[model samples]
Target: MDKQTSRNLWRITAGQRLRYASAIAVTGLASAFMLSVPLVGGYVLDVVDTQDLAQGAALLVEAANTLAVEIGGKPYVAYLVLSAVAGVGLTALGATCQYLQGRWAAIASEALARRLRETMYERMQHLPASFFDEADTGDLVQRCSSDVETVRVFLSSQVVQIGRSILLLSVLTPILFARDARLASLALVLMPFIIAGAYYFFAKVREQFKITDESEGALTARLQENLTGIRVVRAFARQAYEVEHFGSKSLALRDNRERLNRLSGAYWAVSDFLCTAQVCIVLIAGGMFLAAGSLSVGELFAFMMQVTMVIWPVRHLGQVLNESGKAMVSLGRINHVLLAEEESRDPAPATERVRGELVLENVTVEYEPDRPVLKDLSVHIPAGETVGIVGPPGAGKSTLIRLLARLYEPQHGRILIDGLDLLEVDRHWLRRQLGIVMQDPFLYSRTVADNLRVARADVNDTEMMAAAREAAVHDAIVGFPAGYRSRVGERGVTLSGGQRQRLALARALLVEPPILVLDDALSAVDTGTEGQIMAALERRRGRHTTIIIAHRLSSVRGADRILVLEQGRLIQEGTHATLAATSGPYRRLCEIQGALDEAIERDLKETSNAV
Candidate 1:
């Protein structure tokens, strides 16, 4: 694996320290059992050489004979009873041990996965909105789902199983040497060559697997983007284009997999051939020793059995190497997400109520240093005063409001609330004092009541209904099949444009903050409804400091003061009537709206005459 990916794998696996050790113990025990079997068989063979071969045979016969006579000549029945009892007991013990080991492995894998996801989510929550702008949603989903599953599978399936195999090899190899030094030494000569080949293959496999994982993540991202923007795609007739893009990503992933498989296959085939050659040499040498009277028939039989036990675990040594490579791949994918930079915020303190005077002093924002969105702009909103902000497209109106909310910090100057610099204050405390209603509001896929509750969870049903009534959405909500409990569907798609706008207004009202911002919030409503909402806002004008950004003159007509912007600079500031009387950009906007209204009236008259 690449160094960066290797480091990430090490970090994630490090969290499973205890379970890893337990896994080692369980695997070791299993390996030991496999290695011990041949030695036990050898011991039985030794008894034939030392004691009378007939006596050795007679022990089994005698036990059978005694049981048969006791049961009226059933020799087969006697043997069955003896073998069944021993087999059942041994099987139960082995099964119990294996089950516990499996459970430990599962616990380790799940626990590690949970911790990794939690850490990633915590980071995501803190990261700035800009981070989401730069990142792909589908790639994030893949990291949490398929990539995580890959890591879990390695832990439960490959890592622990490979450990067991190695343990068995270690236990069996020594026994073979102790039985006969010459034969044992001969078998071990092939070990270094096998180990070297395994490591070389492991390096290649790790690289290929990492590429495969990245390609898969990219494919997921492409599919998700296509589905989410399917409307645009169909409108443009780009179905074939999307399919081709998705197909390319999939093909890349498949090629990586095939490459890894080829490398793994080569390693296994070589290891298998070497093992077969080793076994043949052992059998030929053992036969010669027996013929020369240097080894008895029983001794030769035992040696052969021990040699048979050693091959699987020796092969397992290579398998373990393979598993390690895959684990490394999964670890890298998860780590990349964990390492991505998170959003920055000031540490919060205990609750502190805000006195709503907002000040922006010579503030400037440059997304890139040479190109400033807002340049040395300064403005103030007095407590309990309502101000309207009127600006043309790309006039930095939205950027100004965002800075006041501390969603984006000004790079060149400071923003203050009640004369204190905003940077020094806690983020949560600052947010508690401000409420924003955007042009396009966000709603959860939940009930109307639940969405309102997000602003203030302790709000009662009576208070909730009151907010809805003030926003003029109460009657429509009550008419729904489930009333306030009706599901809004994803992003409140079930609600009409006007209804959704009012629901968002209701939600903002529930927060009850000292400062309120309305950024073209009433744009979706009819003129009559807009007038009614403005009248309600005017009644509470002196109770809260309100900032409204609008292009429509009628919406901002009731404000105490209006600020007009051109390009990214504030060009005019006064009451609506005062600004309208003076020839400027604000007057031009009013003229545009008047002409549009007159054109609509003429169209309606022409349609009536034709009818």
Candidate 2:
């Protein structure tokens, strides 16, 4: 692992490291007891020989006497019986300790994963809106959920197993050397090969795991896009095209995963062969030494059993390395998100509550560096003034509203509410005082009442119904079987377009903000409903500042002043009657909409007469 990744891992797992260490210590102690069982069994066998019964009996008595003296002068038979019982007791105790070790290890690992996921989610919430514009939702979900799980498996199982293997190797190596140096030297010959093979595969495996993870993320993105756009796909009859696209991504993921598995399998196969050959060499050498009078039968038996213990862990070490490689890749992916730049929340205090007055002075904005969306725009509205904005398709109508909301900061000039600069105002305080409904409003899959109460959770039912009535959607809502308590489905799919817009408008109105912005919010509703909503707003005149943007000229005909925009510049400004009287963009728009409305009225009358 690189130094940065190591540091990040240590920081994430800092609180749980001590617990993991204690588990490893307990496991090592248990292993020590388990390793001694073979030695005891070998000693018992050496003391019993059938060919020389009298001599064997003498040897047994002598061994019993030595053990009895060691235990403070008990009888020889008593010593033998105690030794037999102690062996079984030690085995059971070791098993119990092993269980405890696993319990502690799991606790530490799960705690680390929980902390990491919470921290990542919190960071994602605070990130700047622009960061999400370029990021794939599916990829982020994979990193937050799947990648964290992979790292958890490594910490909980692979790390613990590796530690145990190292402990056994460290404690058993010396005993093997002391018994027969030549045989131990022969066994050590395979260690260098195993180490070199592991080192060689580590880099390759890490790269492959990274590629596989990326492929999986791409597949997830494809699936997410298809599901989100399912309605459009069905309307256009493109189900076959979507299925083919999804299948291609799935196939790529599968291929990458298979390649990673093959590489890991090859490493394990080589490691296993080396371990098996090492054990065979040790057994054959010990047999030769016994025949040549350089080794005893009992000593050879003990050496064979201990040699297997030392070599098997070395074989499993390759598997641990493979898993660790994947974990390192996943950790890197998670860190990328945690380190993104967050939205700025400067410490600018407000001494007084904001009034409805707003001013934009030479405010300029550009999503790209060289292509400006709004240029040299300036406007002012005193408290409680009703203003309307009309513009062409590429004009700066929406951009102006976004700037006032502080959704995007301008590159030059400033926006002030009352007399304070927006850049120096607390963002949360500023947003809370302004209620906005966008051209494409979004609603949650919740009941009608629940959605309306989102802007002000403490609002009473009477207040909610009043707001719904103002948006001209109250009667329709009550027509449903469950009324305000009915489910709207995902993204308000169960509601009509006009119903969704009015509900969104009602949600904003429930807040009773000091400033309300409706950016073409009523386009989906018919002219009759639009007239009713406007009449309701007229009753609210002088209560708060209202800014309306609309393509339909009639919607804004009663405004105190209307501003017309062309390209990115404000071309004209006047009252609706004055703009309609002149020959400008506003007058031309009014004429065009007037003709369309007449044609619609004539068609309705003709259809009625025919019926």
Please tell me which predicted candidate would have the highest TM-score against the true structure: 2
Candidate-wise lDDT, in order: 0.78, 0.85
Say which candidate scores most in lDDT: 2
How does candidate 2 fare on TM-score? 0.91
Question: Mind giving the per-residue lDDT tens digits that candidate 1 earns over 34-113?
Answer: 44444434434554456532323344446767889987966644544544444455455556667778888989888888
Kindly report which residue pairs in candidate 2 clash with one another.
none
Clashing pairs in 1: 31-168, 126-343, 127-343, 128-343
Our model 2 lands, by Cα RMSD against the true structure, at: 3.6
TM-score of each: 0.86, 0.91
Estimate, for each residue in 501-538, the C-alpha lDDT of model 2 and write its tens digit: 89998999888788989999989999899999999989
